[model samples]
Target: MNEIRVFCPATIANISCGFDVLGVALDSVGDEMVVRKIPEKGIRITKLEGQDLPKETERNVAGVAGLTLLEASGYDGGFEIEIYKKIKAGSGIGSSAASSSGAVWAMNELLGRPFSKIDLVRFAMEGERLASAVAHADNVAPALYGGFTLVRSYDPLDVVSIPNPPELYATVIHPQIEVKTSDSRSVLRTKITLAQGIKQWGNVGGLIAGLFTNDYDLIGRSLEDHIVEPIRSILIPGFDNVKSEALNAGALGCGISGSGPSIFAFCKGETIAKKVSESMKEVYQDIGIDHDVHVSKINTNGVRAI
Candidate 1:
């Protein structure tokens, strides 16, 4: 395909229990991108909409990611990209990831699928690094692998796809505040106590097992974040109230999504997910903070062509 249009997905990373490791993609929310193979030698950003960001190939995340892929492929020609952003930047939900993943994915598709998903993920990280100063794969992995993914090891770049429970749903509330990934990441402590580490490990294991076994209660119990939430929760307003209300509304559990500002909750069914959304919406409304709420079934197919 010389020109391909694709639906790139938004992602919730760090999933409360698996800081810097776990992520899931949303089925209905994301960005749209069109990539065209050209006779030129380098990547170019032909269009960008819905967000105020740089258009330069080197400065833009998508452009950077596409360039990374091109550099590795030794392809004779380059690509032209158009990005239509639906996910807001600094919204704590994989804004940069959609563009980055979309670009590299489309590029790989046009080249007869020479690169693996893991390879595409590595290329996407270059864009993320430009956006957040960290080449982490939590968001990109799920954006490409779909549903839930765990960054098992970074040294060898191992990413494991976790089965999504059929009834599992996610509700996310994004207050009108912006929390840049770089800014949110700065507040994190470099070290954690042994007790904290053990708790985090067990919860991560529990979450993975819960999904595998379709145990909603175990999933709920495993949603605890003993390490990152304490330090980062202060960054978002109404976080405590939202989490409490979500739990009260019968949500499985609730906690910060990604870095901050957007909070996500897990529910067993769509009805509870919608109910949890309202509970979360009410908190921001009561706080007089403008917000957006979304309820989505987990996306099993990450990115796809239109």
Candidate 2:
């Protein structure tokens, strides 16, 4: 195919206790991208719509990611990327990740999949590094691997795709506020107590076990974040109320979606997911904060041709 159009799912990173390691893709919300092979020898951002963003090849996330892939592949021809941004930047829902992963994924398809998923993630990390000054893969891994992914290690670059419970659903609330990943990270403390570290490790292990064993209750209990949430929650408005109301609405668990501004809750079914959405919105509404909410199943297909 000379050109490819794809739907790149938005992802929820850090998943409470997982913190830079675990993430899942949302089926309902994301960005659309169209990639085309070009005779030119370099990447370009041909068209950008939806959000006001940089279109320059060197400045945009998609461009940076595409360029990384192009450099790695040694592909003689270049590719042009057109991004239709649905996820707002700095909303903490993997906005940069969708663009970055989508661009590289499309280019990989056009080149007949010369690189593996892991390689694509490494390429996408460049775009993330440009955006947040850190090459974290919590968002990009899920956007590429789909369902749930655990970043086991960075040195060897091992990413493990986890099996999600079939009935799992997610309700996400994005308050119309910008929370740049860099700014959010700035609020985090550099140190944690040994007790907190042990608790976090146990929760991470419990969460993975809950998913593997289909234990919804275990998942809920394990969603607690001892280290990051306390400091980061201060950045988001009505975060405590949102989490409380979501649990009351029968959500399995609720936590900040990424850094801040967006919160996500896991539910057993769509009905509870919608109920959780209402609960999330109610908090924002009472506070007179503009917001966007979405209820979605775990997207088994992360980035796909559309």
Candidate 3:
């Protein structure tokens, strides 16, 4: 028998304009885990904390990811998994992706570490798809590689890494509101015009280039969205106020993190990050909603064994 432990950091995917192709890891929001290998050929999750996480391996996000890893790596063994959930559910913080990444990472270690980082991301995305009904690489990439990543390609193969950026700070605000992924997806438009699509691609390209060059102005200017956010932003109260407040508070760039309710802002330093967090909180407060705010730096390492 063998034991393994892993920690998966929460992530902000899409980052507004990039939509399904960008993400970053947050140091404060995440999940923890402990695992033990068993002789049997089935999986079991014995414990889970935080609200309403499934205990049975068959029904759990981590369990699905573990199964995916086993299939990808050709391994069979029972796993007893314990989950410590730090990120809140429905926070737009990639909670499902974190669990999936953690499980796959832990299982890989227990099985002598067979899959590569991209392979782990693919497996984790598979598990997330089970939860969200879509295979998105945005969360999985940062959960596996850390820092700010551009999912340059995702399909039959996934390729990405941290882009070079000046020291950056992120502020995340999660309002205590629940919006199901299915509902969020339903609100989005399924089609886009050629002009709007081209603008989005241009912004995405600028974002990638800005990261590589540490160009804050370019990054801020490029944080434009012609799709997704416009539709879903309506679901969140005080969204416009929050965004306005963040930028007014000196965030280089700010937008909805993944979907709704939880928002993230990018700042040049801790001072602006804290200010942005406060501003975001104030917006929510004015709207009569309770919220939690975190000011954290980029987590260069996505998930780690502890």
Q: Rank the candidates by TM-score, best first.
A: 2, 1, 3
TM-score of 3: 0.95
Q: Which stretches of candidate 2 lie over 4 Å from their true place?
A: none
- Candidate 3: regions farther than 4 A off: none
TM-score, each model?
0.98, 0.99, 0.95
The ten-residue window of minimal lDDT in model 2 covers 177-186
Name the runs in model 1 displaced over 4 angstroms. none
Candidate 3 lDDT over 1-306, as tens digits, reads 399778889999878778978899988778998988987876788888886877777678889888877767666557788988988878998988899998888888888888888889888888788778787888878988998887887656655775746468889998888877788888988889999999998998888888889998898888888798888888888888898999999998778888656888888878889988988998888888889898988888889988
| lDDT for position 217 in model 1 | 97
Better of 2 and 3 by TM-score: 2
Cα deviation at 63, candidate 1, in Å, is 0.3
Pairs that collide, model 1: none
Candidate 2 lDDT over 149-191, as tens digits, reads 9999999999999998999999999999777777888888888
For model 2 the local lDDT of residue 190 reads: 87
- Which one is best on lDDT? 2
